[model samples]
Target: MKDILSVKARLGLGFGSLFLLVLIISAISIFSLSDANNRFFRYVDGIGKRKELSSELLLAAQQRAVSARNLVLINSSTVRVDEKNIVNNAHRKVGELLRELTASVEAMSPGEERVEAQRLISDIQQIESLYGPVALNIVDLALNGDKDAAVVKINNDCEPLLRKLVEVVTKFIALEEQTSAANVMHSQDEYELQRNQLIAFCLVAAIIALALTLVITRGLDRALGTEPSILSGIAQRIASGDIRAIDEIKTARPGSVLASFGQMQASLSALISEVHNSSNVISGSAQELSAATEQTRMGVSQQRLEIDQVATAIHEMAATVMEVAHNSESAANAAATADQQAQTGGVTAKQAVAQIEHLATEVSNTSQAMLRLKQESEHIEGVLNVIKSVADQTNLLALNAAIEAARAGEAGRGFAVVADEVRNLARHTQGATQEIETLIASLRNISEDAVERMEVCRGLTDKAVLQISDTDVSVTAITTMISNIQEMVRQIATAGEEQSAVAEEISRSVTRVRDISDQSAASSEHTAASSMSLAKLGGTLKQQLERFQI
Candidate 1:
């Protein structure tokens, strides 16, 4: 069972116990006061009783003393009856009273007045010797019948002593009465004070007990209702996954243990809400990972196409270089053959020029001989005409002189002139004939020498003509050889063009192969990207799962 002693209950019990304890203490005090009142009354009563006893004893002694005085007066008049016996009886009664007075003075409350009683006793003793025989005579007179004289003597002789004895007994009674009155006054004052204290204490104790019970009862009712409040509507909402319940719990001023339990309920509800949030985060990550994987695959396919294009362009360039190399080799071989034939033709032309030079020297000598023959013919014709003219002149001169000498002989004086003319005519005719014959012989010799020099010049001209014809034939042959070599080089260049066309076809095939290889590489990159996205998604899922304690 649960110990249900709450703070209010404990306080209520303590207050109730205090009320009972105070009431018990007040009752005990009242009992003690009552007992003290009774003791005070009994003490006053005892004092009164002692005073009453002292009053009675004083009165009895006074009466006995008066009688003894009477007896002494009577005896002083006559000594007839036994005077010693009467005096002895009187002394014995008076002395017995003096002892009783002393004992009562010592026993009574505050009783110091017994000394006065003793002084009274001593006064009676002093008169004893003087009045002893007189007392015996008074007894005899009372016994004989003279009562008047006996009474008169007794009043006159004992009056003053009897007054002293009454005064001393009165002092003892007054002392006892004063002591008893003081004791009664002190006891009455104590009882009144205690009674007032008990009444006030009882009133205060009842008020305290009532106030404590009211406060404790109200406080316990509030505490007992706290358990149901811990599971209130707000607490249920928080348990169903609402985060705002913590704020409501924080604002409440919980004054008991039940309020603390309400706060604990809010904390548990908040914890459950967090768990739900973590689960949602994990679900979202799973969806994101699926979408990312698909996108990565598409990217890989696109990259493969780009790589293939780059590889194709490189292969095409290599094929073009190979075709150009083949064309250059064919052209070099044709040019080398044409250069060798040209060099051989140049040697043949040089030999033909040497023969042509020898033929031209022979033709120059034939022309010089023809000019010498013409000059000799002209000299022979001039000499023949001179000889004919001189012969005619000699004949004419001889006839004329003969005619002149015949005419001079008939004149007788000039027979001598005629004979001289005949002789002169004969001498002139002989000189003219001799001059003509000499000129004819000189002309004949010049014409024969000119004919011999013309024969030698004609032989040298014939040899020069043969050499120039051979040189012309050699130059024509060299020109024909150079044209044939240039034609062969043109034919070889046409064949090289065919080879270049075949190389282009091989290059096209290689480009297609490179494009396919690049596509494969791009596909691999896409695969890698997809795998990385999956890994990232897995990490997020792992983190989301960590929130659950179970």
Candidate 2:
């Protein structure tokens, strides 16, 4: 039965029973007190008072008899008159008492006791009715001065009727005594019975309350298989990875919570021990992996440093090549026109002198540009630092590819791929870094210098004035100069194209490294590793773990 009902059900039943018992006790107490109170009032106001009134009636009747006798014995008229009035007052008192007694009897509950009391009262009334008038008649005879007749009347009529009325009244008093005594006994019995019921019910309530407490406590104990504090301690130990006390819970009752805890602790102990062993092995592997990654990181760092230097050098080389390519293209067009213009006359010769004058102006512009380049060379170191920072980022991203392969949460299957990718990044390191700031600064300075140089180029040089005046003399020299310049332009264009290709390769490698970095971040959540790597990559990462005590 204990097992059949759940804890909630058992508690509800226990409290409900106690509540019902309390209600019943309350009901019984109210009913008994009200009934007892009614009984007390009836005894005091009904039975006891009526009995006293009957006794008074008897005394008053005896007084009337005495007064009538006095009236007969006295000869003075005044004395006779006084006796007559005394007799009348006595009769009135008797009548008043009888009326009260009759009303009381009538009001009493209908029962054998009431009927017996009423019968006795009626007989008293009949005796009083006969004796009262006869005594009055005796008083009247005495008042008329008929002493003999009065005396005769008293002996024959008054004596017998008075005795009968006294006897009937005596019976009524006895009946009232019997009824009063019986009522007292009934009241005693009722009080005793109610008191005993209350005591018994109180005892039962106490016993049942104690029983409920015991039963519910035992049920909870059985359910838990241990104290709540003990169970909590066991749970805490489980969470903290301490299973040494797992055996302690085994003593709990079967099918109880502590028993289940015991089983769970055993399983947990086995699992944690295995995990501990496995973690040890993994620790050694992670150390090895970390070492390999460190080597990779260092290599990437050195490679990026060299790539930064190379890209700087290539940028300068590409700048020189683009300038040469422009010059070559212009020279090629000029060379083609040189032969065609040579077929024309001195007008073409004058044009050649003008071209030489133009060339000298360009040289002057070039010299002015070189001077401004020297001024802006102060900012190149800062730009180079930016390029170095970007190179470091590229290298870190490359290292991330290696890290992603190593810490990819499984066997390091992608390590070789990551290595290949790092090599590819190294090979393509001739490209520019994220040089937006430096490039903008450089462009601004260069544009300012170009504007100034263009202003300088508008003026022809004095050195270019009289030297090439012979049109025929410098024609052959101008054609030969044009051919050489065109060849040099072809070589410069080729170098520029090659450098562009290298920069493109570097861009592709940076893209691959960035992708791998993102993959590493997403998969392993190696935030610390990412943070360390991003130092070179010019970015930052953060790591967080959830907190749980148990």
lDDT winner? 2
Residue lDDT tens for model 1, 1-550: 3336777567768776876778687778869787887878777666565566556545554544445445544544334244435445655555565555455445544434345434544554454333444444455556566766666656664445455556655665666566667677778787787778777777777787777778776665455434446547545654454434344335444555445656666576566556555545445445545654565567556656655654565455455445545544544554454454445445444444444454444444444544554554465455445445544554554455455555655663454443454445445545645654654555455445445545444544444344344444544554554455455445545545544564565466556656655655554564555455555445455554444232
Clash counts for all predictions: 14, 3
Alpha-carbon runs more than 4 Å astray in model 2:
1-13, 33-37, 75-82, 187-207, 232-550
Off by over 4 Å in 1: 1-12, 66-158, 226-550
User: What CA root-mean-square deviation does each model show from the true structure?
Assistant: 94.9, 59.3
| Per-residue alpha-carbon lDDT of candidate 2 for residues 220-276, written as tens digits (9 for 90 to 100) | 888888789988988887666566656656478877889898888667667555543
TM-score of 1: 0.30
Error of 1 at 398 (Å): 99
Q: TM-scores, in order shown?
A: 0.30, 0.41
- CA lDDT of 1 in candidate 1? 31
